[model samples]
Target: MKNLHTRRHLLKTMGSGILACGLSGRSWGQSAESGVYGKRAAEVMAHTHENFWLKKRDLYKGAIDKDDPDFIWGGGVMFSAVVAATRHDPKYKSIMRKYFEGMEVYWDTKVKIPGYEPSPTAGGGNDKYYDDNAWMVIMFLEAYEMSGESRYLKRATEVLEFVMSGWDEVGGGGIWWHEKHTGDSKNTCVNAPAAVGCFRLSKFCEPKEAPKYIADGGKIVKWTTKTLRGGNSLFGDAINVVTGQVNGGQLTYNSAMMLRAYTCLYSLTGEDIYLDEAKKMGVAAKAFTDSKTGQYRDSIKWSHLMVEADLELYRWTKEDYLLKRAKTDCDFHYEAWKKEPAKDLITNGGLARQLWLMADMETAAGRDFWKKSDKLRR
Candidate 1:
């Protein structure tokens, strides 16, 4: 197809832009607070927007469109980044419509509880894991907050119903990994982000109706902590429902999502315990770094969430060390980019988004990066 050919050409022509350690940064990350590096990050974000997402059904795949069935979970994190990039600068405003259309490509609205589908979903198929739908809920909420669009909120609320459908008496309390795989293990990936969704959904609703959403989120978080708590202030990967056993593995996003949930709860209730727990998890996440090479063990996509958690920690404490750690981790990724940059949509998009996020945390030019919109607010 014409699109596929163009994609191939674009992918091969990155030549210099992609090799400058993600846009010619100065002094590793010391200038993260300055506008120069922030602008460069925005440029990288723009490159990703052009190469992979000008218009495509499969946002997780390469520059070209494809009928991919995998990585639906990564789509949510990518969507969050997309929505954030659009809000961070008005230059990305062109992306908003394309984003909605791409969502249309993935969503099957005819289902009982409407949620997204894989690319080119046949027969309006609603089949997917609960975690994937939960990821979409997070993105839709971001879109709503960023655009102040009621439709985004309504879509997110509908997806919440579907996500809650994933929960039951299983494993004492947690979301099923997939809808059809009834006996599958309950995963922290689903539980933590779903908790974050519920927390955000609470505020998205009316004042009187908000309490139920909040309570639901609190209950999910409570059950998650009690059911599969890991040592060293970290969390595990999953728990086998059939065998009643926990898979004790720590991942960056799992810890990051919990950190977000805890931070949200603290902000809403003024609870120091939530903040304290988040701090513990933040500390544990740094164990990924190799003191010798200064390289991080986490892949770019997964490690981005850790950077997000670190930024939140920085926000709360105003600690320079947290920012420095985040900067170093980012530097590690860019340094790798100089040699072998990932060409896939998830990796490139994720790296750009996280780098921009880190730079935004320090620079006043991006002061409103975490806010709904950093631009002139349309």
Candidate 2:
């Protein structure tokens, strides 16, 4: 509860105080390591926020067809970051509204899918990406929670059902990554978030209808864990439905998505099974972190989602090391941002989210982890 309030304050101030001015490009020139936990983190968060609002608004501008918010199913990743930014600040309300409207721009209404195609009559994006649609449901659920809009709630439910249509017994019970008979694999990327969608969307449903989503979430989790669980409690990438070929790629986002799903189930059922699994995934995620290097060896595009899970785990377990990783990860990102600008809203918005979360964590635990008023020697 305190974290919620702190974040709300952090975001509100961040929107009005930092984003109000044209604080574009860089917030601080290179400096030595000195920080007041409160101010420095806000400075960094504002810098990241500017990259999206000023440098790369095209990612969610919602005016284009080819690069719409739902482009390639990664738009929702940026959407999640914006949703987090708004969690504690009302100044971002208008920006958040545009994001909701952006989804409508991508919706293929006649085809019952919400994704990018050139036009309403273009009839191309209707190929149906279950994973993309599932990701939409998750974002829509959050939109509903934030705005209390019945349309978002309805959209989420509709998308959830649409995503579930890809589920079949062929791959031992998991949704295919895409629809329209094109996809051949059952993916952890899809199933893990699909489980999360089921659990969260249940919040607005009737009691009779709610538990069913819980069960469905459990089913998705069971299938994914059984199929994708790798050594050290982390998850692998995907499996071919027909050939039974497993692509053993370990990604941070996949592991984080499962961690999120497990946490949702734990919160829903108050069951140790869910909490224990979440904890296992949390501990296993250490494989991606290198404290000595202040770096994580994974897709930078997805690190934002991955560390998002780290923050979530720290919140529940009060684990110091997880928080430390989160702070160190920010240090890693600060260097990364210095070398190259964030190429998309996912990286920019995600960086904003983690910095914001670090601020909230600092407030809640009386810690000064993100002392980013300093410059890295690199």
Candidate 3:
């Protein structure tokens, strides 16, 4: 009776605390105003915070301990999930701002061109991955769009500038995967999202600045297409700078980012070529979907990006099939997650990402997530 009373008291205080924070009961997945996806998103958000977030550090631990803070890459995905949740429940915006402040631990200040390193500053840091920073730029921009926060936009631009520093004549003009040039290869993972970042920046910059970003983004698209594209218009992993050898291993996210890049270009340039290529790539992405399960073939890290791509495509073409495919895959994944949830950093990040994607599906309402929005203002 004592333990049960304690548990009941804990639940009561938690509910009161949520109410004090201006969140509706539905925001806790208790009611259905936001729909099933929104409810699940709220549940996963709570789970992630309860399991991973460290209030003292203001950042997330990789799992349940203080010893292993999550890497910046996974943290960036988690950041994205927080941003997505804010779209539906504006009460989450405060938590998003707190996370933004906490993420500074990964910002590498030792280098001339500072960017986010893999590890935190206290451990003396590690290699600065362009792909990791590129993901940050994308998510930071999302936060900026939703909150209209100048700080988020400024940080996005700064990180993107660091990523741009990775680009050179290497691998015939593409961004290297990491600052150390470990593999000496330019990857679709980095370049594709970098291109998307550039195109996205074009939207927010001054008219004079917009042209440069678009032109630069176009150059990246041109090089990436000519160099790394493989059979059926799908993108391969990476290309060695010295040997000109292509790593033919394909991941869904590579194609997914490239697909978004193409679509963004189409939106900006209104070019039929970019639109045509985007449609082709969207169709090709189906190859990554499982025939039996209808879910994406890869883990949450890779698959959620494709879900983002499909949703973006659906926004443009009004294609029911595109939306349907994304919804089905996410629905299946959500059910699976309920039975056996992920416990680690990256998988938990992936869990948050899919819930984020589901929240996007719920609140999209014809608004383009990539663009700046006044609608998301609290």
Candidate 4:
């Protein structure tokens, strides 16, 4: 019994040591390559570029389709443009134009109100996902910043007006996750981006009203802290007042979204609470990553969520560790797909994700491995 107790104590100590190491930033992977930062940036751009083409062909019928909410297609465009800006690639500009064209159609057809419909046939086409629109607006605004286009900014403002329409009295003040009949479900995924959108939008709008955006963002952050906590950490999902629970499972994407929101809030207000939450979410996300293999598991789909988290952490903290892990995880997933052809592994989305990671890795490491079709490029 004494020996067993001793073993348990030793294991506990080692575990604590590992956790401390992770928090202290010593355990985060560091690349030894020169020009790693630039290489990873370029690699990420290339990957996004490839994914844009693949997703366009397979997911959206060769162009930004108008059958669905503009936000969905807008997200792909936004993500692609972000990569393009980072890498200074011109192809992304063309992709952004396609996305903008789709949004123009959506703006023309969508009811000029504060809500959106997920689909045309569902719920009288009067519903909207708050975060979806919020993220779309953010993407558009960023695109404007990158390209200096006034149309993008105007469209983004219009979307923001729609997003604010969903704000109601619920769990303090948070944007409803959805706006159809199920507008009561206020998940972190929806609210976080809403808060971020409000804060970011204020920067381009009137300064007098900027306080309102800041206040709204603060309220959402507070509500998230009060309602989204399970034990001492953020809940993987939440129960909506109208729809009960939309997402019961922990998703790496959701977590990263939350991180993005928190970081935006921190940047806007210079608040410590937002910064603290970002760090906590960042660390919690680290657990989803395989330390031995450096692959991030998709907590919801069993697919790798490394790319999402990598981009989130990179943008949030500008830390090299997150980028390194992203590269390693991409390499692992690519190799796995090569060895066994799973359905998910063979999809355009999967390949695009892999290529994006590889490109980002190369950009950061300043190494060109696209020519070599080995484990790195598999």
Candidate 5:
């Protein structure tokens, strides 16, 4: 009993020291490859790996207690971050590959239509969420783009098929959030990302098939904008599939995905209207930035995608203020983390999204991967 107690205490100590251990390596002021953002991103990632990663399960637990595995939604977000980190350092490539292998646990093969489930199948649940699978499609495509791995692309395509299965004429053509259709609402969360995923998949498809993806993406974009867009370019949360009543609450990532969709559509079609829409949304999204602190108003998961959309817009518009806003938010958050770590932010999934966003800021500021003049790869 004493030995067991000691082991438990040791594990607790390790979890508690995560932030300190992660931040101990370098001076807060110093910059490294890809500048300060890159350095700090590495630190936070290390903490995530050490404290939350469950090597035995080859998956991340939600928290340091080793209880529940991360929700597949959060896992997908984290996977994208891991893929992004590989751009700054090749060392992350091995970690990214292994993590992707682990993520397959969420893949449900027993169903007539295979898609990623919200929880690990080994734990015996079978329900799938369209939004969760949509996120997987995006993350898998990103992994494929980075590593040129055909398997990643293949998996992304498979998940995208599942996402499309959720689409129906109910309430004028949008993807349902759940496979079981548990909710009456079809969310912007699923539809917008599904559109972005279609645009992304189009790049790798054959000429005959590629246009279909683009057309589908366009249809989704049009439906979502008409159905969800509110004042100030803010998108509402969801719309009831049966009643057609709109859920008026606006969220940052909803607008973020729509902004990315517009940017991607502009890249594909070279339409000034798409660019104009992206700019309008980008301008309106400035409300999410705190006036005094300059920090993002949303939680880390939602706000990171907003910053990513900002960077995508900046790439096209060559707007310096977009970069400045991203830098200010990232810098402030990094310092804030160091000064007084947000205890609530220490979860495996949350840190993963936060790390992904910080690495994107590194890419924006470091300018190592692509330049403002480079064509946006949709």
Candidate 6:
């Protein structure tokens, strides 16, 4: 009887705290009416940005290798710049410049396989992964747009060519996942990034300059949609080449990639279907969240899908609910990190991703900070 009374008292105290924070049921409604959601969302994004820069600077010292998927570091840089641009940050441009410079050495290097040992001894080996090349091109194109640098654009164009070389009709006409090790198997992961690459490429490539690429991008988008839809409408992380059986388990990371691809396609074509698909994916991805901790598992049940999806969602939609959820998730992870900051599985990469998300979110919200920095840049 005493324990039950204690539990009730604790519940009452917690409920009172919620009320005090102005986060109680009625307060949430009033806050939304007064645009509190937007304000809070921005705050969350700003917090994310500060944390990301601090962590990334500590982790990386030199240029990341282009050949290894694990070493594909340009995406974070590009994402950071995007958030910076959204907030109008000046430092973002400098960070972007550094990232571009680090990646510039591999601009002319031949495309490498997606998952192969990086050779320090050999100069150019042929283990080209389509997704890696596609993402790299996407990053370069975004950087070019942010900086108006012809060099970034030029590098993006070159990378696009390399990415296109892997295009072959497999799994009913879509981009192959990998080049060196290829069969009929296809994955949305590869196709989505390729679609983004093509969308970005269209911006710089003229009808006369690279008509084939423009056409190829359209075909790839069509193929990706058809393949993804034919199987489940919701994409699988990967597919078996010979059997054509899709691995239907949903992953938060790839879903965001697909959402971005669809959104980009919508941006290019003004198609309602693409936009609708993006919104649908956004809604579906919400299921990835853990209500108690607010963190997203890497994959739904089996795969340890990390915080990457949370970052992607925050990037895709500036929705307050998503931002709040991301904040809670980041808080949960950070608290966990405090306990064990260096545990390989839970710490290094996971913590890095969590911090990146936090930084990205904060950067998204730091509009005033960005304006001040932009003024300094001028």
TM-score of each: 0.83, 0.76, 0.86, 0.67, 0.85, 0.63
lDDT of 1: 0.67
Clashing pairs in 1: none
Candidate 5 per-residue C-alpha lDDT over 188-307 given as tens digits, one digit per residue, 9 for 90 to 100: 999999999987787776545675676677778878888888877879999987777899788888998999888777776565767888888888888888999877888777777877
TM-score of 6: 0.63
Per-residue lDDT for 289 in model 2? 76
- Per-candidate Cα RMSD to the true structure, in Å, reads 12.9, 12.0, 14.6, 12.5, 14.5, 15.5
Candidate 4 residues 1-378, lDDT tens each? 453343234333323222232322431224334344344444444543443434433223222223223235334433543433433456667666765564333332435573333322322355457766776776666566557778877877777787778777754556676766274477766666666666666666654556566566656656665566444344456656654454456656566666766666555444465566677776676666766775676621323333654554554455666666666665665456457433321232344443444444435321222112111100
Which run of 10 residues does model 1 get worst, by summed lDDT? 14-23
The deviation in Å at residue 50 for candidate 4 is: 8.1
Instruction: Give the best candidate by lDDT.
Output: 3
| C-alpha lDDT score of every prediction, in listed order | 0.67, 0.64, 0.76, 0.52, 0.72, 0.49
Per-residue lDDT tens digits for candidate 6, residues 266-341, read: 5544445655666666567667777666667652212122244333433434455655665566566556645644
Error of 1 at 4 (Å): 53
- Candidate 6 residue 362 Cα shift, in angstroms, is 6.3
Model 4's C-alpha root-mean-square deviation from the true structure amounts to 12.5
lDDT of 6 at 368: 33
In candidate 5, stretches whose alpha carbon ends up further than 4 angstroms from where it belongs are: 1-34, 122-126, 340-378
lDDT of 1 by residue, 142-237 (tens): 778667878788888988888888889966878888777555789888898898888777666865556567667777787777776676767788
Rank by lDDT, highest first.
3, 5, 1, 2, 4, 6
- Model 1 earns a TM-score of 0.83
Q: With candidate 2 superimposed using the best TM-score fit, by how many Å does residue 207's alpha carbon deviate from the native?
A: 1.2
Question: Rank by TM-score, descending?
Answer: 3, 5, 1, 2, 4, 6
Candidate 1 Cα errors over 4 Å, as ranges: 1-33, 54-60, 63-71, 123-126, 362-365, 369-378
